[model samples]
Target: MVNDPHPPLHEYQRSGDYVVGGIVSHAFILADSIDFTIEPPPPSLEEVTVVPKNYQHILALAFAIKEINENPQLLPNVTLGFQIYNSYFTARSTYHATMLLLSKLERFIPNYICEFQHDLIAIIGGLDAQTSLYVATFLDNYKIPQLIYGPAPVMNEKTPGLPFYQMVPKEDVQYMGIRSLLLHFDSDLVTVKGDICTGEEKLENLPGPFFEMSMTGHSYSIYNAVYAVAHALQAMSSGRLHHKAMADGGVLKIQHQQLWQLHHFLRGVSFNNSAGDMVSFDENGELVAGFDIINWVVSSNQSFQRVKVGSVDPQAPPDQAFTISVNAIKWHSWFNQVQPLSVCSESCLPGSRKKVKEGKPFCCYDCIACPEGKIASQKDVNDCFECSAETYPAETQDFCVPKDVSFLSFEEPLGISLTCSAFSFSLITALVLRTFMKHHNTPIVKANNRNLTYTLLVSLLLCFLCAFLFIHRPEKVLCLLRQTAFGLIFSLAVSCVLAKTITVVLAFMATKPGSRMRKWVGKGLATSIVVSCSLIQTGICTVWLATSPPFPDVDQHSMVEEIVLECNEGSVTMFYSVLGYMGFLAIVSFFVAFLARKLPDSFNEAKFITFSMLVFCSVWLSFVPTYLSTKGKYMVAVEVFSILASSAGLLGCIFFPKCYIIVLRPELNNKEQLIRRLY
Candidate 1:
């Protein structure tokens, strides 16, 4: 046991039978220097400074008891008294103060009774956790109720109860608490009209620099703590008086043994305060209350204003728990009008995806755009996906757009040009064939095997018509005939030129003396050449259709934003083989026509045949590289254009002069004029 030589700052007053205990930290100590020696000087007022703000806590306790004593509706017959001690903010002083409340002065014996009628009911603890802990530990054995009127002790579940009870709620409750919640326990202090400040009147004025030394956060808690003890004691005394169950009691008498019963009454106290808010406690002795959400705005003059912005209610459903009205918030001018992005990495926008950074947190990432032909439907997606077969990725890659039906159609500009060219050439070929038929008896028309001429012109007409197969929507029949038909038809036209070349050579030989080549110069030899060369190409197309034929298919990869309805050649080898065969026939005809160009006979036309073959080969030769370089439906257009150009080349090169003579120059149709040109 220790004895103090100097008197400390302490206050005590006896007014009634019941006494309440208080331990408040009214002053703090500052040791100017610590003496490291074994014996140190005792703490005194020379080292201690009183806190002006903390005087309000002790004042709240005094005012609460005064308000209760003056209220007639509450505690009609009972009066309450109190003993307050300055804790000096030290655990040793706090515990020593708690002992004085239990034992009488000059009697150091344990369990000594009070010398007066004042019986200690409960203690309002010191303003700090460590001080309250020391006071509670000393008072627990006696079972006296200790109400903590300070900040709630931060204790975990396994921390074992430190303070006897709680006044404020746990710190974690404020994260999800109600708005505008406080106590009415000390709001009437300013209206108390008389000399209410006691010895601390200098610190009691409102709107002053020290904030009137008013009831702060902890002071409010102290006010509520005092009201709680008063309510519990009144209820306990009233119960005994109303039931008349107190044996040997006229009104209500509280002994040291029955003080523990006040814990039960205080634990069950659930009345609403004057603020219309419930001053209730849960089973764990935590205050059943809430917290208000405030936004701190610092103005230009450095004035701080707290604005109530939003709230979070723990009792509400999860989606509705947190509610905010953004328009109510006022932002500083330096922040700009829009709220700035403050995240480590902003979320990836649409048309891009999140790429996690190596060796970094998950929130830290890089954003990359979606690959071509793919789309991301929402922001922060991990990867982009391809659209359905009938759709394509939009330009932004944020969504999929429906694909347009694409092919070489007659309505579009390219289609209209190809269609007009094909029909114009066919009409020109038909007219030439008709002109030859009407002038069959003439010498120029009868020359160069008229039957072979007719066969060649008719095949060229069909070749021009073949270009229509590449236009419009591709079907099963159209796809089958599109490539193969053009190959076989062009082959017939080339073979006719070959036959006509052979005929001119044989007839030139027959004009020699006693030549046997004249017997092979009739229609039999010409027809055989046409049939044999055409049959070879016909066999190739037959094998193509029988083995790997063309079929209608949609091409999505060839174009970024379209689906081309085209013919997918089943076997690329066979399709090339068909084009190769036509090239071979044209080559053979060009060689034959070139050799016989100088033949002097009047009927020989090998020079015209050579020029037509040259035109045909030039058109198809340039078609290959251009066709390979282009994408989508443009590839089909190139092939169609090649067909039209080559057919027109053969028509113009071979028959333009002949038609000029027959229609415009009638004298050139005579034997004399032909003989003059041939010589």
Candidate 2:
């Protein structure tokens, strides 16, 4: 009788006879048990039969109804009845069942709000997702409460009249539970297959048929749905039967409007079930607890037992949401009980980077080596970075090593050569100074402003000594003193030559009696010339120091593999100003001496001053282009070479002949020999 087709309308009418309200439940009992093609040629009605396991969903609903009826606290003095229907898992059958619940008539009417049977309060159970969705469309128009007991269907539109609620969690929660189980066992590669159940298959040897039941998820949903509906009704009744005024003979009638109030009441309902598990619904009418994860482990006898592995609770915090027993999971025998690799490509090694494969996921990529001068220290790096200027990539391109600190140190060949030359030139200047002091009273020594000659020799000695500052790693004091000292000392040297040239012109003109130039031919004129010319250079150096003085700095960008430590002339303008002033003195001295070169004096120093100034200007003019073209320590070397070469030119040109006359030819150095040669 239970396996027979749905009983006539009289059977369902009997359910409403002694009940104050009716709750209808629909299940796909017959259709789910049969094997049929999904595409062409629909199966005939004769091919379908109810599987006993699938009928458990209907039984669960029935148990809830019986439980509610027995509870005196829920719906007191009234019986809550339920009508169970077989939806056959088809849209047509589910729609017909909804129409039957709506009205006893055969024909359907659109916008049917008025209930033919006021005893029907809420509708529950459409175990198939599509069937539930189809039934929900019509029930929503009349503001009916539809409690679905299956995978929650996605509803795009909301109708005010349809208050649909779901007892089961959404399908995504189930997927999450399955994903957590797979991740727990570290099983990467997995195979999945699905089979349809035929009614002819024998379930005798199966483990209670519950494990093999295709609608097991729906059965559990139905179990929860029954308890949910019972609780909702109990909350609505509040331990009393809700009824209107007596219709006849003290029998009370329930209004359709009053039954619709269950929709609002059910939304706020929450309670613990028989298992002490809390059950509640969110604002979307979906269960909040999500799903329970079950692992089906195959036993040694080839029989399978279900193990509770974990649960996915969406309401909980993310870290506490998906809990699982990782050790309890059992993998397939073919996998050799080890985790499998699931990536599309192996990971990139150190010194290599990942190149993502086009039209593929991020997990799939190609490994490429890092470019030259760049390195990837970590494995699977997406990009490589370049080394700093003072560092270089290692052989494997996995790390950067610091390059050696380089400068014009005194230990190096170039630095040693420049130092030796500076010292040698200084010694020669000292010798020349000693010779002039020894012959201080001689005619040739005192002829060309003797005081100015001493000043020039001292300045030349200092110029040679300043070259030593450029031979080592620059310090702050060295940087400040190097250029400034070079400028002032060279200025004094050129100023002395200018004074001598002027003295020679004045001495030649003062020979005429009563000439005004006689007064300017003394030591006062030469002293004033040297003092005033040197004072202007001292002022320029003072301004340069006050504004933007030079400091020690390292050149990291100029050289690829070395840090060149040198002086950074803080202001190029001031640096060139110093050089320009010195050149100005040299040029003026050269012109003066050139004009006075043919004067009638045997001891004329004009030709020597002109040649010395020419050499000074030539060396400096060439120094500019050479200094600008060089880099690193070579730049310092070029400047040092220029200083020594120019200083030596001035010393040999201006003072060497005077030394020769005073030391080697002492007879010619007397005043009589000088006056006789001049006349």
Candidate 3:
């Protein structure tokens, strides 16, 4: 069957060929394009197995394929199909299914792509981390991207480069919680470990002898994934055939793009999924770096009583603090960095290093290190330690032979050579900038020079990004970094605005015959004013933090984690404080422009500043409300909008006037002509 490009959709009888975008597509032109019929490219494998039946992965994949087939006018006439096999439980069963899929794919590969020329991508489902690991490797061998709706760290750990992507919290993050719990508990001599429960029979049956004695799994993760996907697909579906298909295609493609850019597919996209808080992955594709740890106590009857553990919200909220209990449970952990020494002392006795022995004092045991040049991440007394990268162990005794650094470079976890290179790069950039400034003084001297602004803005941007990373998902060192970066950027921006205002005031006052401030208002005054403004803001911030200590809450409202910290951006007072300062500058600049209207028309700097302020303020004012209204990726988008708009305003004000004169009034290029025209 072929679809006509100009088919009268209203008159055409409903058929299997078209899928609508929504439940009420009859009243809406949901689809705006034409569909074409191209054969699906091919399937890498004929029979692919989905382990543990991840509802969301299946749902998303199903909708994606359905959409490609039914897009109105997109592929005017095409049919796409998929074959799904379920790998219910256990690693052994998962392995069996993988082999079956492999065998079938071998037979279908040559013809599948040609037969289905239009369908180039295949989505495999594995909300189960263990199972997905096996499936991801299988798909990676074929150069396909597998969207795993499972934990992040598991996928990465199992196959780091196997093209496996995730839309859930990573296991590394889960470990973050575990590690935090261990540290917090040990520090205070609290003898308890957090347990995980997944509400699955298979997980329930799995033995826990090898891992942490306190670790267990729960069903909340699986539940959340299932319902979240269902909600998104439900919203995306249409009752009509054509529109429905188009929506599906659009959503799938958009989601892929978002994931590629390191955003979470569902939560990060700002899709409502009934999660308590609107969940979204951060820039690293991690929804939450730390989970709540509940200490489990076994009663005499064997019933477990789980006490609440501390919550780690990177952007902590007000009123939540580092506490031991919340809502009936004692929080045993909050994510914070544990020193390598805390885990095991850096200095060890002659015959022993650091090690963990399951049955001893807080699980501490002695570890032995071999003779010089030999290293291992883990070592226990009496057990032979494996040699670290760059060294190979000799069969005879506890000694290591060094390998060439080049050969060991890629394999080491923290490659020594690469670390040194990164440090050098930073040093070089700093030295070059310092040298340039020393040689070219105008950049430092100019009050509103474009070169100066550019340099400052670049540095400010780096500072902003660094601040984000420093406190991002807050652990130990991040706290200090976050605060410092925030203070620095706030100071810089405020200082810039203040300097501009002073420049305007001084320039206007200079027009008067007798004004002492005018004589003092040169490059030195501008620099001094800028520095003073920055220092003032910094002082205010420091005082506020000292008086009302802030905790870390990932969300601005700060309800999830019980520990909010003082940072540059989270507080309402901070927001208003900065806004107030900027607002004052804007008002003064406007006033200066109004007064300058009577002055010689050649002085249009005030007018330019006024224009820039209007745009800048409008952008920020609109941003506050929009930012407050959104939770995840959409909130992030609002910030992006504010940034882009502010930049555009600055660019227009700086360039638009010059562009007008050059392009529209070339005759005014001459200084005499420009002055005469302005007058």
Candidate 4:
């Protein structure tokens, strides 16, 4: 004997659920087999057989079931195989067969709602119309959904009164086919004469789009039926994931539930068939599709040889026939209208670009073109690029503007390029004038350490002016200009703070009047102090340029958007760098102020400076955590708050005491009196 190569399924399965096509059933192997003889099931007069005494009908049904099961209509991973019980082969034995099958396959069928009774799972054969009708009534009483092959028309109708979906064609579809044939012939006599002459009338009367008897309809019907079943199987397999995840053999449990799920899933599905139009069912469970219409050409032997008629919709009622009229022809005219094209608005002119209008569409304000040397690039651009010193915009009309300056905002939609650039030049001019005026008034600047005080006052003013760069609204050239001015002013402010700290430290260390370091404390020393601070400011600029420094703490993207340059230090980095640098200044200032306590009260300016450092440190230390946590517009709010607070403190520390002394006590302003009181 040849050995079978296929392994036994017993090894693959464990004691668990078997989900097949969405129907789940628990399988268990009995530990003991009971020897029981066949007997009538509590002989109830209520039980009756519905099939006639013809075995061929039973055989045909068996064949159909076998075909459906064996056909490759289910996914290979979850294929269905059928089991059979040969109920005794006679009409009366139909009930006996059901009972016998139930006993044999009790494991496969589910228990009824009434206390663990297995619902009989048996297929009944309908030899004649009576058997099918009887079976339909019987099944209806029991509420079992069954697949029937009975020839009775009543079986195809609502039997259980529950939803009875029929695969069989109804009488209406048959009548519609005949009407479609008359239309396709396009005969003038049929329309005008209204003569239903003999042979054709009988042909028309034959009640067709008959049960799809022809090879064409039969083939499409069978194909679509099997295809639909395959679709159900596919849905069942794919949708059973939640069940499968529960255990290794949860397929059985998933299968039962998903089977009905598969039915609902396929109800509204539409797919292309051999017929051109989509094949689908309407709200009522009926197949309404446009299939080819074929008419009988001649009778051969006993059967009719049907020829092609045309095509028609099977779902449409027969009384209402398909026709084309002038109204139908006129509907085609809609195709003539052309689609409109969208043209982008022209770009902003040389010095201008489009800015998002504050209130209305297509509304914009023209930006002032920086002088002839300046140029703009990009369309509807916010800002124009400035010509550094060498290059210029190629044309007044062209949008691709050029700039001589090597620097460009990393971000494109920057709004403050020109304003920022102008501000930087103004700051430089102011600083130069302030420096020159102090140097030129030699005698006056040298007296009473006035030059150092003048330089510090000028630095503070420059720092305050730099804050405007952050406004950065829509304007050509303002982007670059803003960054330069703000960056330069911030660097200068930091340098001035450092210089003050150094000045205090050095003054305390140089207590000896004849010390060489003391000789270096006049107008020349003040000039050196300014230049040294300027160098520190320059170093800050170099580092900022290399790193693509960030804007003052604000919305993360706002600085980039407004400045057009990417901020190197984002929230966290920005906080640490700012606090670290300021903290260094605070430490130096504190140490210097402590050491300089011995200095004469007249020159005890270090005390006020140290107090200012403490206030500044306290403000920023609190600002860091809040600044880092906030983002976007809220961050802008926090930054604005910080700016206002810092500015207020600085102004108060520098001017409040002097103002109080001057305004409220004018006599205190007298030099001799103030000096006498302090001493």
Candidate 5:
């Protein structure tokens, strides 16, 4: 049945007597030339300009049917037939054509008796999206299969009882083809000028008669639709014939109502087409295939030629989806063969970030330099990041460089000065020890327990040497030795001072009658004081090392541009405990020496011990705030300075007077002078 609504129904003809199937195709014939100046856009009911190439789709469909019918293996003992129709490319005309195909009556009434029995197995035309949609609504009610040759609109909530399959790929996959073409030509700005149905006249004057004009996607879709239907029918027929031969050895049953089986078989069908390309359908009944990208190359004669430059395969992985042959693309004359940039703004360079513009595409952004201490290593970074703890940003803020490691190194000026001072003080202490040895028998030398004085001088020498440990890059061994040695040795020195002060008081009291303090005025008491006080500090240090010992570590957080290699005090409480014990000994010695300074003995050394303890306490008291306030290597410098200054004070203040008496006032060193002063 030919569904032409015009008066000239010359192309409409009945099917052959042995027809087994039907085909519906839209071929518009121009009745009159349309006038563009007509108002109201020419009534929707009027005849419009017709395209002659639409007939090529019809011919392609007929050729496929002919090829399948000639092959005995495809549909044995069966033949295919067709009923052509012209939709006039309009919704209302396509609806009337569908009504006529379903029933011979002029008007469509649901379940009405028909004048003729039309064995229409399937309907496969209506190339326009709107026309197909209108036809699909009616055929779906009766489960008639509709094969569309172009992209169909999404179906509404109404159930499509029949299978409505589209032969072309979806719109998104088509856009991928367009994008590949743009990239092939290196054209950033693309203008899509017309609708899908409108053809460009520039494609005319091609090589062959069939290629006289550019073909739309609908033409290729029609070619594939014919092959798809043929494959489904062959599979259905073969199954039916096998079942009949196995069960009853009878003729195969082929009923028009079994078209639904063909629909189900088409969903899973896969085969090769005449072009040697695999054809199949997705779950949504749309063809699964890649899109071909076409580029228009302009020649010197002002003629354009279409070239295949690329393709986009939606079924491929994301990275390999779109590919193009860039060398084959021909740019416009104005480009001078150079590629064009199409972004909304210039790309952000290195060391700068991209700030997204509001209400704009991702390609449009503002370039911003990275902030201080932060870096953007890559181009067009969304935000800059801060450098790592042990690193610092370079001058350009494009790289992160490792920070310079710093410590109180002996090679530097500060370390050199501290070390020289320590050696100088140590030498002075040695000189004082030598002076005492020379004047071993002198009254002033033997007045303060001579053994205790020697022990104090040796400990002060060790204290001066311990400051060397803090002047260089701290190691684990030095970290453990410096504080422990300082604590133990200084304890011995202060304990000796306390012993001398006690001895002075005891000797002064022993001069009276029946004084019992004479028993304690010997070396035995002084030795016990030094040993017992040092043992307590030694115990504290042993426990401290056993539990949480200090270790060498890098101080990254203390300074921004430098990594300070220093000792990490493992336990703050234990460290302070050591300092507290030393402070306790100093305070006790200071008070005892202060009380005993006015004793009535010409040989009393309490005045010197009192002044030495006062100096020691003052140096250390100032050390705590300075050590806490300073940072990095300077903090270590302050601690080392305090150690040297305090040790020098003890050595100078307590022993300098004795050296003066022995060297300059040698007359006062005799026992006769001491006894005369006592009288």
Candidate 6:
């Protein structure tokens, strides 16, 4: 239907404190007024789109006010009445309807000047934001409170103090309801970059079975808004009654208060409605009502059906605030009746992490495998984390594995092999010492200073035994003994070899007639060399112990899934210094033995000493780089192997020839073989 002026409306009953005027849109007009000429009266609206659901909003307001007047406990003797007006979905019609609601309703009385005029106390603003704002702005001048029953207005600083209370939840709540619907079906809301829909919309001639009394929609808001005013009026009447009772028997008067000032009474109103839902306002005068989630399904007749699938209550606990029924609703044909997947890339599995894609939204990402020494134990984990000190990432890099207490213990195969090596070398050194003791009086055994020979053999035996310190699980006492014992014992053996080299030189030099070096060729000279050299090493070891000693420690990061119990050289500098000093002794002995190797003395063992020193130097020279490169228990194994190998080299290269002569070639051990070298 097309119209340009006001259609006739049925007259109101004119009861209660004053009529509650409702401004609702029954139809939407197509175009805006174009001509800017001042037409004296407002522009007329035409070419409308009929909306049956909004027309029911007008009926809902009358129903609520009539229901409140029939209730015995509410507004007992004061009945409530209502008057409805058409907004016609236009600004001029909204303003005209609001002005008519506030003007005097009855004018032709016998005593027109003396008769009481019906004034609108409050207004239920229309079914959309534009109509609500128009009526709200006009009513604001008269200090009247307008309740918005449709969409909440997008108010800003410029429109503040307009004095309107929102009856429906804010527009953001509609978006949240949709979000909950998607989340309950295990899907995510996608980002759609598209153009805005700015065309005007009209709801008409497209539906079947449109409205129901039980449906919680915008029409329900109109019903609640009218009852809210009734409760405010009831509260105001009760306060007046209590004030009169407190006075000295004052006569009761009715209908004397200004209804427009009920804005003051409405502010203090808080009560439960007939539906048992509490109707209250926040500090900003907007009602704190949540939204009911409805599923609108278009049937074969092309009409949308509202099904209650969920509700969003802000008053509930945070975790329980939003809920939805997935099976109770229907999905679009594009989803194929199956729940839609989340609008994102496939989730990153365990042992993997998310790598965000460039030039895209944050949720869009690439799933990458976790790096070494770290783990991602959950799906779609944003980042991978390293395990704790006592744990490590599992082989799959999905979870943390507690580290086993690992060491070169006597139980494992490597530890058993090292232990056998140390023990066998120790036994061979002992037997060599015994063989030398049995042949002490022979020219071969007595040629080198016998006392120095005994000391050298003893030190070698101790060196082999010290390897046991590096075999077991490293402890406080063992850590204290491990490096120091190896250093001191190896230092003594190398010093003995150096002293013998010096003794052989001194003996050949002292053999000359009238030589003063004869006095120094005795035990005193060899004794001083051994004692002084060993004493220097002893002092160095003492200082190392006094400052920083080796301590037991665990290596966690050395291996991917194992923690190693090993000795931590407390002062790494001191540890290397000990090895350096022993190396110096070997080098000095090696050069001296090489120079004297061809000396014409049957007892000269300088050639063998040079070979032994060479082996010791080579083994340790390689040990430094290999030790630095290894990790965890493997490092301890390397140190133990080095100790055994170098000790075996010294014992084999130096003493093996003597053992062969003394045990198997006794004929060569006689004095006849001891040809003194002519100096």
Whole-model Cα lDDT per candidate?
0.69, 0.70, 0.42, 0.40, 0.70, 0.70
Which number leads on TM-score?
6
Off by over 4 Å in 3: 1-491, 514-517, 544-575, 597-603, 655-679
lDDT of 3: 0.42
Candidate 3 per-residue lDDT, tens place, 1-679, comes to 2122223322112321212111001000012222322112222343323222223333443454455445543333333344443343345444444433433232233224322222223334454456666665655555443444444324345467555434445555455544454444433222333222232111121121111223222233333333333333233332223455765644333222211222123333344333455444455534443355454544456555765445544445533422344344422122122211333333333333455557645334555555543333333333345554435655433455554322112234333333343344335435444543443433122324544454444543443344223312344445434444445564565356446655666676787887776677677776786677667767766765666534443332232212222223446686467556655654555565555545444535556656766776788778778878855324433453454455446545643564455446656545566457566
lDDT of 1 at 169: 58
Among residues 3 or more apart in sequence or in different chains, the pairs in candidate 2 whose N, CA or C atoms overlap within 3 Å are 140-162, 143-161
- What's each prediction's TM-score? 0.51, 0.53, 0.30, 0.35, 0.57, 0.61
Model 4: how far residue 665 lies from native, Å: 3.6
Q: Pick out the ten consecutive residues of candidate 3 with the lowest summed lDDT.
A: 21-30
lDDT (10s digit) by residue, model 4, range 2-31: 122111222112211111100111011111
Candidate 4 TM-score over all chains jointly: 0.35
C-alpha lDDT of residue 299 in model 3: 49
When sorted by TM-score, best at the front, the candidate numbers are: 6, 5, 2, 1, 4, 3
Off by over 4 Å in 6: 1-186, 189-298, 301-329, 342-406, 438-443, 672-679
Regions more than 4 Å wrong, model 2: 1-372, 376-382, 394-399, 512-514
**TM-score of predicted structure 3:** 0.30
| 348-388 per-residue lDDT for model 6 (tens digits) | 88999989889866667899999988999887778999989
Error of 1 at 407 (Å): 0.7
Cα deviation at 235, candidate 6, in Å, is: 12
Best by lDDT: 5
Off by over 4 Å in 1: 1-347, 354-377, 382-390, 676-679
Clash count, predicted structure 2? 2
lDDT of 5 at 570: 89
